[model samples]
Target chain A: MIVTPWKVSGDVDYNRLIERFGTRPLIRGLLDRLGRHAGHLHLQLRRGIFFSHRDLDWWLDMYEAGQPVGLYTGRGPSGPVHLGHLLPWFFTKYLQDAFGAELYFQMTDDEKFLIHPDLSLDDTVGYTYENALDLIACGLDPEKTHIISDVNNIGHLYKLALRVAKRVTYSTIKAVFGLTDSDNIGIIWFPAIQAVPCFIQSAREGRNVAVLIPAAIDQDPYWRMTRDIAEKLGYYKPAQMHAKFLPGLGRGGKMSASMPETAIFTIDPPEAAAKKVMSAFTGGRPTVREQQELGGDPSICTIYAYYYYLFEEDDAKLAKLERDCRSGAIICGECKARLAEIIKRFLADFQRKREKARDLLDQFLLK
Target chain B: MIVTPWKVSGDVDYNRLIERFGTRPLIRGLLDRLGRHAGHLHLQLRRGIFFSHRDLDWWLDMYEAGQPVGLYTGRGPSGPVHLGHLLPWFFTKYLQDAFGAELYFQMTDDEKFLIHPDLSLDDTVGYTYENALDLIACGLDPEKTHIISDVNNIGHLYKLALRVAKRVTYSTIKAVFGLTDSDNIGIIWFPAIQAVPCFIQSAREGRNVAVLIPAAIDQDPYWRMTRDIAEKLGYYKPAQMHAKFLPGLGRGGKMSASMPETAIFTIDPPEAAAKKVMSAFTGGRPTVREQQELGGDPSICTIYAYYYYLFEEDDAKLAKLERDCRSGAIICGECKARLAEIIKRFLADFQRKREKARDLLDQFLLK
Candidate 1:
């Protein structure tokens, strides 16, 4: 059994990744055009934690040819969208604007009823539509995107889904998704439902390759299963862009939107955002002089990590900050203060866009 | 737990049966009308054999008021309609012509597929259309009679059937139909499909208080399950008229159309019908004198039983035949000869009608 080498400790090898997933001609051209107009912000293609690939070149070819490749992103809508939930939409919105790709966002509302026993059937359907506004507010363009809720739109797609579902067996699903016996039969059946849209990407409804699924690393197993099935069903394998999990503010495991402090909502007030930042877990020693003598552990400091991920647009600014932190030229509190301003300014722009999107929710939700 | 008296023995105590179910207007009137039309050779209602009731009063009242309480009969359509299959149709056709009530005959194509794996999907569908022509040839008026096959006509009725099916459970179906784990799931799901049409009766495509199910007593379990489910689903329980099982020519058990010797098809030649009749199981001793010394048992004689079911039109003729057979006054040979003649002549008119019906098969088989 041969294993792919572009992985490190079961995570993506970031340095070897660029040559592994060479940028498509169209995306490279678009990046060049952006540099001409707005300057470069580093041409990075995020790789998911659980890396798997099939026919990436085909999608890249389609992208290079300026053919339409629809952006497919969806959430369970089990709860409110948090910082963790924003990753896919952030990339999707960017790609849609950058490459003019068609975007399709879905809410798996019917699946919630099957998964959550306490949820009333009617309430399960109502929540998906209600949550659609929040996703649109996250900068998804109505002109380029079509939003679908599983409850209302499923009827149109169910027959196709059921056909694919019937071909995949329970054992194969269990092996790929790590499903246990205690899981509801509905949950066991969920991967097939998600896989249907991947095969349905072409403009001809039941025809060829036009789908691109941008999901987190943990979700790669589902796409892998879909790819295997697509080969058997004579449907094109959907192209994938997998991203690593964003760590929570506590420097714990993955960030979860359902947990409050772990994820910052676009609506969080500036004071609250500042407080979250001040208390954010740091790896620096108590005194600045001790930190200067010992230098800093940037890997363990959550605040510095956030700055690298969210701010630090210039290479000189990032290098100076790293050197200053090591020499005690900058303390954790001063660094947090700088990070709070970046967060506040980012939220302000997002909130304005959210307000404008809310005004046009009817157009996105489409009744 | 106390079981009903009728549960112990299959036989119904007439007085007790009357106290329980006989007073229903349909039951009383059906018995009275069968008595009134006894003299007609071509069209007459059968007596004593059909002995069950549910909401029979409503239909009888409709009959008494000169309203359209039509004749209803069905064939399983697993095989060609035989001599035994003609019993219910014979009476139903008589009742239709005698009273001018609309007729609704059913071909249980779906049930065959459910119960027997050997019956292919194509054959199951084809049998219904083929059997419809047989029913039409048996003196049924095409305009007055509506023939339905379960699968083909499912869209016309499946929604109501599914609702009625849900109300019936594993426990209720198992008890009434004697289903076990070894039986196919299709068989388990089939009773409700059969039951729905009983409650809805007209398919809402015809007149009211108009449905009657003329079936064999061996199939009493299906309607019993139907009645139980109808009460649960809040639909009207249908009126039932059950014919006794016609015995097989060789075995003491019921005659099945699948066995060529037991069943005399309308397509059977006169010589073939005569040969089958001559070889039928008899209760007579070797010699006529030996039979006289020890009286023949009509219960064990298949030939005498056929006459009791079909040939003995009048009560006086049936009683005389029964007495003569028990006393050994009539030889089994002579009696079989008499029966063969009656059957041959009866099929002569049927054969003529069948040829005409075969030409009209296209009109009926169309949607």
Candidate 2:
């Protein structure tokens, strides 16, 4: 399946996408190399969720050589923040703590308004604040993180957008985004806005600073274009770490805000989240007795996938759960109940942090 | 024969352009209608230099009904402000003086930087200040004028540009500017920047105000697109008054800074202006004895055009000059000398005004 900035569809093949995108695999030993500098590898990195990269080794080399590196990642605030949205941000927090790098968290309110005809500026801006609370709850340091909404901080971005826009051609955007004549000019122009943050720190410091972007693979196209023009604009090409998508609860595709029932929003109450988890699709036999006699497939089960992706951090415990399911020792009902309890506990903690984040919002906002 | 926002070429037929663009001609009685409010018609209107319009009568009607009206005009700042560039600004000043309207003068430094690959942002912004001096020398009221360069005043313009950019589509800009796939994305996005000034006053005032633009026919495309989507955005449709181009010296087409010797810049010293005037092309017989027998054709003469357009505003004096030339009573050498004296006199006064304009620049800048 093809992954552009706006679309993610089909049964995505991660190994094939890495080859197609011409990015290097995050090899086994690279985590150890990163651990040497970071003190430890992030769960996402250790579990192979962040499986592909471009020029990351060079960026780490620069950091080890006592050069500056900044991190950039963003959210498109069309709706509430979902679990899918938090995956990269959590890793970003890890990177920040590990490398002591400054982070630029962009809320692309302008992008949402341009791509979605039904969304007004006010609507997207409201979502930006809601999404920002989730980012703050992810444990990023307020002093090192600069959370910027496109509309609120446009004064800092307009000049850089102009510089990037002047270099990118209409043909390039069309090929990258599948834009046609019917697309709004704002959409045609938005690539420049997305590209600006990659170099903004370098521009602000009046010198070249290596930019490292840790984001989902769906956003790779924007960085691909940014990387192509970065050196030409007198900055280092931004290095990217691509993360795998968290699948939707009910279906085969990634968790998306467009499908509310299939995604767990951070704002969802505990009861609602537990209900969704209980109803989520799983790979099991027709009957519990049949599943006890014939083993279920944990590899394709959403409950098992959730635990593997986020819930269970202990490798031995996760391996035991996978073995029990394959051996027909655990049933789907028990697995769902256990997953719901884990989710409820996680949400309880997250909700408290989110409330605390509200008071610190001003500190992280880019003025 | 064709005129778009980015290109103007061939021997343009004004009447045909008016027909093709679906604009109304500024007929004889409209000047008299304007005279009722303005006290007297400006020289450009009297000489039919302000030849065409779109919704101008409606704007005047709004003025008569006691509605607020604002004037908008702009420069590309790619080079020096030549005679062709000043034609519309002078007319804009006339409108501002007549109606006590606020003026928004945009210096499109960003546009020039995007369209001209060799021109840097510094180059275009440098030209903006030089062009602003020429605009101020044209006798505009500094208190009523707001001079904005795209880069300097982008903080005020970015939100409005986003609003404008969202409404326009890629096909519309491509059609209006003849942009190809190879054109930079900045050029594709620039129409929104150009369109922002038209509604800026209304946006700032928090109410609709009638906007009237005075510009050459080459800029008509921008207004055409602006007018189409204005009502959809809940703003008044902007009115436009189109002026005829000033012919270049020794040429059949408009005066342009690209052809340096053929254009007279506002910053040109009196001696240089006289030199250019002396070498100007004129309609005359080969010999003085033959010119006495065969009359010159003022219809195609650049020297005669200068007097009609700018120099000789007096009806009686201009009529006599035309009659004498047609009667073979005025020789080419004598005509050139008279034109040179007028140009020198005009430049001497303008240079002093331009020098004073530098001091008042802060008053006109939109911060």
Clashes of each: 5, 0
Tell me how far the alpha carbon of residue B360 in candidate 2 is from the true structure, in angstroms, after superposition. Answer: 1.7
Relative to the real complex, the DockQ score for model 2 comes to: 0.76
lDDT of model 1 at residue A51?
Answer: 33
Query: Against the true structure, what is every candidate's RMSD?
Result: 11.2, 1.6
Interface RMSD of each: 8.8, 1.1
- Least well predicted 10-residue stretch by lDDT in candidate 1 chain B: B1-10
Stretches > 4 Å off in candidate 1: A1-367, B1-30, B33-46, B62-72, B97-103, B201-210, B231-234, B292-295, B323-329, B362-367
Q: Write the per-residue lDDT of candidate 2 for residues B1-367, one digit (tens) a residue.
A: 7677666778989999988889999987778888878898899998889999988889999998999999999999998887778778878887998999999999999999988889888899999998899999998998899999998888788777888889999899888778889888888988988999989999999999999998998898898888888888789999998999999997688887888899998889889999999998889888898888988989989999999998898989999999999899998899999999988988899899999999988888995
Q: For every model shown, what is its TM-score relative to the native structure?
A: 0.54, 0.97
Q: Is the docking of candidate 2 incorrect, acceptable, medium or high quality?
A: medium
Write model 1 residue lDDT over A195-283, tens digit each, in one string: 76775555334456567777664556667777777766676778776655555677655565555786676668866877787878777
Give me the displacement of residue B275 in model 2, in angstroms. 1.0
